[model samples]
Target: MVDRGPAPRRGRPPVSDEQRRRQRLAISRHAVRLFSEQGLAATSGEQIARASGVSERTLWRHFPHKESCVEPLLTKTIDAFRTVLHAWPPDVDLAEHLRSAYQPVLNSPSATDVEAVLAVIRLTHDEPALRAAYLVLRERAEDTLAEVLSARTGVPSDALPVRVEAAAMNAALKVATDDLIHETAESGITPDALLRHREHLADAISFVTRRAPGDGRD
Candidate 1:
């Protein structure tokens, strides 16, 4: 099985969200460059730690293994989705809102952040372990989307249609992100691509809202 990171974080919050996010992003940056340079299996946590200016213990403190480093990279896209979803307006069409907004946000990502995201996407195909980490993250993303959709629609958590709609939205996002990663790693995931064809993703999310039993909650 792929070396997914440690067990799901079940305990009370460890550190402040900002502090942990900083450390995770720091480790993600170092690991990506190192993996791109030496190749995946050849890179070690110790080397990543040194490159990140942290200790071996600190490396594990953030990521359980070398492959797990990509978790944050994959999550960068999901995080974007999360941010947008949280801010989604009740009146606006989901697809149109995302299509109009995604590019600006993506363009705003720093060069290093973009590089790390591309590096992980390139390496994912060659590493089963990293792929597992990516999938695990995506599954968590489904729950996140579900919760947000449920809250917005006021659907009960166990409602089957809500779950199905959440699944469809999550699935659409996964495909869009995978396609973006593969293409971006080659030529680049362009603004036009996100701005123009991006409605496919929004449509996917919107479809789920329709799948719900009634008019969307919000």
Candidate 2:
């Protein structure tokens, strides 16, 4: 997990939505480290709070349960992918757009953030609660994905093809992320090294969608 220097001082002014989000993300980073070092069943909310330099009340205020603490980081990953999809040009192919915009590193997210994400994802394979949280976030992403696909294809978001493609895209992303993380564990994972993973993700998405160039009506 990233070295979050310090939690906000107590008795500070009320936080804005963005401040609250940052706090949650900071707590989440610490929680992921604890979860990685200790299994979900062994970890406690109090431990997470202590690790985050926040109170149990504060941790619970941000996350309902220990497993749910991972939501913010997973949500960040989903949001990054959504940003790429939303920016997809009508004239460009999906793979082509992703190749340019979908860098996992060498961009906004730090190396520590990526490692934390990888740890959380790996844990989900054995931890049912964490898996639930992860899948739920991915499930929620379907709507945003459907909307973007609809805009590109001129199909209603509710249409069967659009919905199926959106869901498939999510699955493809999940699979690609898992594969890349696993592969990078043995080899060193660096900002530049992650670009290959990005390419792999693009390839997975392209294979699953089989979308044609100029498919976007818009």
Candidate 3:
């Protein structure tokens, strides 16, 4: 007769949102490294699970597809930027605020996580699957930016001008991020470089919206 294991323990405690997010990001970091070293096509969910020290079921619970493993890392930067934008003071210059907040945003992701994210982004250039994922994330970022801009400007998110500004800003940010990723991959990114990039992003938004510093005031 086959020996049965002891009765399973009753109801497991629910994972907190923060715990879930961290788990997902951790898995993503492993996935990105694998996808970068081995081609995405060659990397399997089981391999990713093994690399991340999680069960395959747990991996799928966080990411529906392999390509999506990059989402959590990508979301870290997007979420950091969103947090910075949301905290913009009405009376402060956008560029000034961005410069001041830049350090925190850059520091949001660990050095390892940042490198993983950059690797995935670099893969996007050659992998159609990863490119699709990156594009989807960018679209989501645009919507998020529109919402933030609408709140700051007292305009509807769907308003044409607001939408246009958000799109343009996102585009500029994408370029800046791509540049940063490539540059950092080669050498590394300094705090000053990140600050300058933040200033550039703020300037791009200001230029596209034709809004001067402190114009966000009611």
The TM-scores of all predictions, comma-separated, are 0.80, 0.86, 0.85
Q: Which rank order by TM-score, best down to worst? A: 2, 3, 1
Ranking the candidates on lDDT from highest down gives 2, 3, 1
Q: Which stretches of candidate 3 lie over 4 Å from their true place?
A: 1-9, 103-109, 212-218
Per-residue CA lDDT of model 3 for 1-218, tens digit only, reads: 98898977789788999999889988988889899899999999999999999999999999999999999888877887778878888787766777677532334544566666678889999999999999999899999988988887788899988788778867767777776776677676676656666667767656665663236554
Model 1 lDDT on a 0 to 1 scale: 0.72
Candidate 2 clashes between residue pairs 3 or more apart in a chain or in different chains = none
For model 2 the local lDDT of residue 68 reads 92
The predicted structure with the larger lDDT, 1 or 2, is 2
lDDT of each residue in 1-218, candidate 1, tens digit only: 89998888787676888888778877887888888898988998889999988889978988777888777666777777877877777766677678766531233454456556767766777887877887788788888877877777788746887677767877888666666665566666566555534776777667655544333443
Clashing pairs in 1: none
Q: Give per-residue CA lDDT, model 2, range 88-178, as digits (tens).
A: 8777788888988885522354578878888898898899889988888888988888888787667798998888888888888888888
Instruction: Give the residue spans of candidate 2 off by over 4 A.
Output: 1-12, 105-109, 212-214
The prediction achieving the highest TM-score against the true structure is: 2
Global local distance difference test of model 2 = 0.82
Report lDDT per candidate: 0.72, 0.82, 0.79
